[model samples]
Target chain A: MLKCNNINVKNILCDVSFEVKRGSFTSIIGKNGSGKTTLANCIASQRKYGGSISLGNTSMLDISPCDRARIMAYLPQSLPSPNISVYDLVTLGRSPHTSLGAKLNKSDIESIDNALAVTGMTMLSNRMVPSLSGGEKQRAFLAMTLAQNTDILLLDEPTAHMDMHVAAEFTELLNRLGKTLIVIMHDLSLAIKYADNVLILDSGKQIFFGSKKDLLVTDTIEKNFNVRKIENDGEIIFTV
Target chain B: MKKLIIIFTPLLCISIILGCAFGSADIMQLIGNDTDTALIIILNLRLPRVIAAVLCGIGLSVSGVLLQCVTGNTLAAPNIIGVNSGAGFCCIVMLTFFPKASVLLQIGAFAGAFITTLVIVGIASHINAFRGTVILAGIAITAVLNACISFLSLLDSDVLTAYNAFSVGGLAGIRMSQLYVPAIIITGCLLCSLILSRRIQLLCLGDAIAASLGVSISKLRIACIILASASAAAVVSFAGLLGFVGLVVPHMARRISGERTSKLLITSSMIGAILVILADLFGRIILAPTEIPVGIIMALIGAPFFFILLFKRRGDNAEM
Candidate 1:
């Protein structure tokens, strides 16, 4: 389990408290400036925060970065395309587990291969990262995070630049990973459809945190996201 | 790539042999008749110059590779980014103030280059450390340092000839003794660079991804800057602001070796050594008895190549 209590990130997030259960896919939904990304960064320990975040019994702040990386992986929204091959890039995920010279052992190679297979990037593993299209690049990064072999995954706007088909495919992959995942999602319908649980942030404050069904019934989403109405014909839809 | 290395290694060896044999004193003439004069010329004069050029080449190019990786700009080089100028300026100041204290010159040069690098990085860090910002900051620093150098030239006309010689950069009068300290420093730094190659490669992915992969970005950046500046400063202390070997050699290496940092580092050092030796050979032979400075020769070759590269890949600053 990943827990955050009274987490405050200066100027971006404040007084946020939440607990993410193991094997749950939680999507953080909010407006553009609602501090969703900040919350994700704070939890990942990428950004400085006031309160406590713990994985099981250990405090996150107390762990070294390399040791912390072995337990959790965080992928940012966008990255400059590195000139290295996809295989080499994904193998970087093994860095935390490797020694000073970054010599990969047998287990590291197995995990790297597993990550490539899981992401369906085995065919394109030899291609240069800079040559990949947007969706492929995103998948490549996702493979790297998966190769980290961490219990918790924090992804910020993972589907922002991806097309609809690719986004759906990626969401399916995430669902099957079975790790504790905290995703910052911009698309309301996608979040509603894919998330096992939902956390709603409204201008740096945690407005709601509960099961996805409870999130849909509450007025919090409508108020926070400026949704005037939500209806279901064949599927649930929101009109903003 | 392997084929290119195979070809280039032999070419480098030939260049070094030719460079050693055909200086002002003819090695062939003194070889059969008087071995002593031949031995002295070959061992004391030509050999050290050749070795110094090769070492300086390796040092500057490795420094360039590190700077380029950390700054994420192909255009980031020791000469262009104010490292060489800063070192040269500090050496001038030291030489002027403490004329007899030769040890202070090298120390001053390293300190100056390191500090100037810090300033450039500091400015770039505040505003995202983008390519354009780093290049502009470098240009500004270079201009300021050049002005200081000119002022120093006017203040002490007696040191003007020595200053001019150093500034132009040559291997004409170097001895075996002069190369010992720089050779040690360069070798040590090169070893460190090779050890850190994996981490440096991670840096090419940009800050966030590198940090996520357990790299301490700030610490790595500082280490890179220190290593780069120290190497460049050491070279400048002996070679006098040799230009473009750092800028051009890494690019040449990349074309042959791809983007793997370890491979790139090794190949770049080799290519760097070759380029400087060849440049020095041309500098010696072109004017015959009156030698051109290797710095001028490098700029003359490097500037045109740099311009062609810039134009050929106009918009893709990140890749080149």
Candidate 2:
């Protein structure tokens, strides 16, 4: 389990507390400047916070960056399009595991190959990162994070650049990955579809944290995002 | 990459041998008649010049690679971005006022280079400027530093002759005493850069990702700046603000060796050595007794390459 207690980032995020069970999917939904990314960054130890985060029983502050990276991986929103082959980019994910001056072992190669396959980017492995399309680039970076083979994945707006269909497809891929995940998303319908639990924030304050169904029943969606939640044919939809 | 290195290594060896064998003295003719003169010319004059070229080449190229990676700007090279000017300005100050403090030259140059780099970086970060803005800032600072250097030379006419030779940046009258310390410093820094190559590559991934991947972004960037400054300062101490090897050679190496830092550094060092030695040879032979500065030849080459890169990036943006 991943637990965050009273997480606060000066001016950006206020005191927020939550716990994520292992092998569960949690979606963070909020308006612009609502501190979704900041919260995720705090949990990933990418930012300073006046709180404690622990993975399992060990305090996150006690773990070295290399050890923390082995347990959790983070994918930030603004991805760079570097001029490197997809395979080489993904190979970087194995850095924390491999010893200094040591080559990748057979198992490491398998992990890389597996990550590429999981993201459905096996064929594009040889393509340059700058040449990949928007959704393809997203998957390439996802492949990198997945290759990290960590227990918890923190992704901030992973589908922000994708079209509707592509976003849905990518969300389905994330849902099927079977890892503990905390993803900040803008698309409410997709978040409701894939996430078992929902955490809503408004202007840096945590408004609600519960199951998606319970969140839809309340007026939190309407109050926070200015959208009305409806259910039809066993499908959840949010219309602005 | 191996093939690129293989082809270039031999070419570099030949350039070095030829650079040492042929010069203003025509050592070949003197070898039969006066062995002492031949030996003296080869050992005292030609050898030191060739070694200076090699050292400056490797040092500047490696330093460029480090700066480019740290700044995340391909146009960030030592000379083009005010690093060499920083060192040159300090050197002039030392030569003009504290001529007796020869032992402090290297340290002073490093301090100058490091301070200038920090200033440029500070301005860039403060404004949150883009990559091109950083290069423009560097160019602007370089012009101001150059003007200061010229003004200093005007005030102290006694330092003008020494500063003139230094300003044009040629290998005309090099000596063994000038090269020994820089050679060791360059070699040591090069090895450190190579060992940190993997971590440096991670830096290209951007700050957040690199930090998330266990690399200390601030520490790594600081380390890179220090290493790059030391290398550029060592070269500037001897070679008199040699340009272009840092800017041009790394780009050439990247084309041949891909974006891998180790391969890029290795290829850049070799290609830089060959290009500098050959440029020095060309400068020596082209004007015969007049001796064109290698800096001029490099400027002729580098300025055009810089424009090509600029337009090429614009073209790529257009394509995208």
Candidate 3:
């Protein structure tokens, strides 16, 4: 399990403490400025934090960069569609897998191929990333993380601005991966659908963090979430 | 393919060797001899000048590529941080303040580039500045430093005849001592450039991604600044300030090889070296007996190419 102890994420994130178990699908849901992305960046070791963050028995700081990259791969909310071609960008995922002087081997190629295949982006593998559609761009980043083959993934809003069909398809893709996936999202339905555990944040503080059943029973997000309006009957409909 | 690319730099060197050796007509025959004229020109004058052009071109372009990548801005050159002006200002002041001081002039140029590099890095860190800020700081400093140089030059305008010649950047009057250091520096720098090329590409992704990939932001930036400073300093020390090779070479090479820094650096240097040698030849042949400074020729050709680069690309500058 990945553990956060007395962690105070400043700037955007407040005190966020949770345990992410192995092979569990966990999603973090929060409104804008509520610190969802901050929490993910903190976990990914991309941000400075005040408290202890431990992966299993080891401290996050204790991990080497190469080891850290192997342990976790992060996909931020903005998928930077770089100017480089898709194949070259995907090749970047092999950074942690190979040593500085070592040549890439067959297993690495297999990993990249599998990543592209799983993301359903094989046909677009050679295209420039900047030229891709929003959904396709997100898939390319997913492929990068997938190609890294890390044990834990911190995805900040894995499906933002993507249409229902694309979002559903992307989430389904993540759910099937069966990895220790900690995703930050705003969509309530996706939170309810995929999360073995759901975390809700309001104004930088955690409102709830646990199974969806417990969360909805205690404080179901209604009009406050804006996009997802839930009736008192607990019936939820998501709209732009 | 890599072998083919590695061959280009050397092959271009040979072509430059031939260009310097076998030009039209015979200046040697006209000069007072023809017997060991080829050998004399090869050893004493033509060879050293060609080597100067090749090494300086490679150094300048490598420096340009390094800075541009490290800052993640296409506009970022070693000159952006007032480094060139630092060199120029030092040269002008030494020429005015100490008139006949050769040793002090070289020292001044080195001191100028080194100090300016530290200042650029310092400002970049303190301002939480991005690449654009660094470039702006450079331009602003350069303008101020150039003003200082102009004031000094105006004070000694009549006495500083040599300064006028060097300021325009020429291969003329290169001493053996000056040539040796730049050659060694370029060799060492080329090695560093190759090793750090991949890092530059990774770095261009922005600080956050580079950090996540295990690149120490401070360390990479330091390496880049120092390396670029060394290259620009060496070139400025030898031949004064020659602009646009750094800015233009990488863009042209990127058009062919895409954005990979290592490949682009090699290609840029190759292109830059050829461009300089060709320009030097044009300077030689343009009006024969009167050699136009290669710097002016480069500016004439390089300016239009630079605008094309500016238009063809926007770079990763937006985040910065």
Candidate 4:
């Protein structure tokens, strides 16, 4: 389990506290500039914040970088495609486990292979990253994070640039990963469908944090996202 | 990549042999005659000049690779990005102020290079370190350093000829003793760069990703800049302001070896060494005893190649 106590990130996020249960799919949703990405960065230890974050028994600040990397894997929103093969890119995910010489052992190679298999990128492993399409590139990066074999994954707007079908497929893949995941997402409907719990931020403050069912009944989403819910054909839908 | 290395290693050997043997003296006579003049020319003049050329080539190209990787800009070279000019300008200033102190000249050159790098980095950081912004800041710094160089030349008319020779970039009269410190420094820096190659590859993925992968981006970038500046300063202190080797050699190596930093670093060094030796040989032979400066020859070749690369890449992203 991950716990944040009164986390304040610069001037963007203030007095934010939340708990993310182990093996739960939690989606953080908010408007643009609502500090969702900032909060994600803070949780991943990529950014400095006030207050404390602990992973199980260890404080996040006290964890060594390599140890932190082995525990948590983070994928940024958008990264330019480096001119490297997918195999090499995924192998980079095993960097924390490698020795000073950076040569991969048998276990490292097996992990990379498993990551490639899981992400369905084994066939494209030899292809250069820059040559891959948008969704394929995202999967390649995802494969890299998977190769890291971390217990918790923090993804900042992972599917923002992906097509609807690809996004749905990616969400399904994440749901089946069985790891603790905190995803910052903009698509509310997708969040509603995929997330077990929701954390809503409005102008840097957490207005709501609970089960998705509880979030649906709260006025926080309507007030913060400026969207209204409507009933259509016995199904509930939200529109701005 | 291995094939390129195999092909280029022999070519480099041949170039080194020709560079040392065919310059202003008959190789057979120098070997057979055993006269003091011939011996001195071969041992003291020709050998050191070839060594200097090789070292400068390796140093500049490695510096170029590091700078390009850190900035994520293919156009970021020591020459074009003001590091070379900055060092050269300070060397000239040292000559003007302390004309007799040869040791101080290298120190001045390194100081200038380091300060100029800090300035360029400062400007780049403020502007978010975008490719265009970094290159623009580099160009601006280069212009300013060039102006400073011109001013120094005007201040001390006595230093003009020496400054002109050094600024044109050549291995014409370098002594064997001058190569020792720079050789040690460059070799050390290159080794460090090789060890850091994996981290550099991670850096190419961008800052956030690199950080998430257990790299401290700020520390790595600072180390890269220091290593690059030091290598460039070593070259500029000795070879004057040799341009284009840094700019073109790494790209050529990348095209042949792909983007792996380890392979790229080794190939770039080999290719850079070969290029400088060939350029020096061409400079010595094309005009006979008159001998064009290697820097001029490189610019003559490099300027056109740089323009071609720019034109070919124009349709791509403007960030380059």
TM-score of 3: 0.90
Local accuracy of candidate 3 as per-residue lDDT tens digits, A92-135: 78777776535569998999999999889899998988788889
How well does model 3 score by local distance difference test? 0.78
True contacts kept of each: 0.49, 0.49, 0.25, 0.49
- Estimate every model's Cα lDDT from 0 to 1: 0.84, 0.85, 0.78, 0.85
Q: Where is model 4 chain B poorest over a 10-residue stretch in terms of lDDT? A: B311-320
Query: What DockQ does model 4 achieve?
Result: 0.57
**Per-residue lDDT of candidate 1, residues A44-119 (tens digit):** 7778889999988889888888888888888988777877789989988887788776578899999999999999
What's the C-alpha lDDT at position B293 in model 1? 88
**2 versus 3: better lDDT goes to:** 2
Candidate 4 residue lDDT tens string, A1-240 = 999999998779989888999999999998999999999889988878999999987899999887888989999898777777999899999977875555788999999999999999999999988889888998999999999999999999889999889998998888988999999998887787788899988889888889988987777777777888776785556689
B1-320: candidate 3 lDDT, tens digit per residue: 38638767677967696657544446556456665666766667776778788877898899888888877777777677777888888888788878778777776887887788778778887887656777877888888888887778778665468677767888865666777877777778878878766666677766666656666677778888888888878888887778878888877777767776667888888887888888887887778767878888889999987876666556643332
Q: Write the per-residue lDDT of candidate 1 for residues B1-320, one digit (tens) a residue.
A: 47767877897798789889987667898998999999988888888999988998889989999889988888788877788788878878877888898767667777787788888878877876444676788899999999998898788886676678777877878877778888888888889888888788888876677777788777788788778887887788778878888889888787677778877888888888888888898888888888988999999998998888777667774665
What stretches of model 1 exceed 4 Å from their correct place?
Answer: A226-240, B1-8, B25-36, B101-108, B114-145, B315-320
Name the candidate, 2 or 3, with the larger DockQ value: 2
Stretches of candidate 4 off by over 4 Å are A217-240, B26-43, B80-82, B103-108, B111-148
lDDT of 4 by residue, B1-320 (tens): 67877898899889888887787667678577777877777788878988998998899999999989988888789877778778878888888888999777767877888788888878877776544565788899899889988888898787887788877888888888888888998998899998888888888888788878888676788788778888988888778888898899888887677787878889999989988988998998887888899999999988898787778767754345
In model 1, pairs of residues that clash are none
Interface CA RMSD of each prediction in angstroms: 1.4, 1.2, 2.0, 1.2
Q: Weakest 10 consecutive residues, lDDT, candidate 1 chain A?
A: A229-238
DockQ of every model listed?
Answer: 0.55, 0.59, 0.45, 0.57
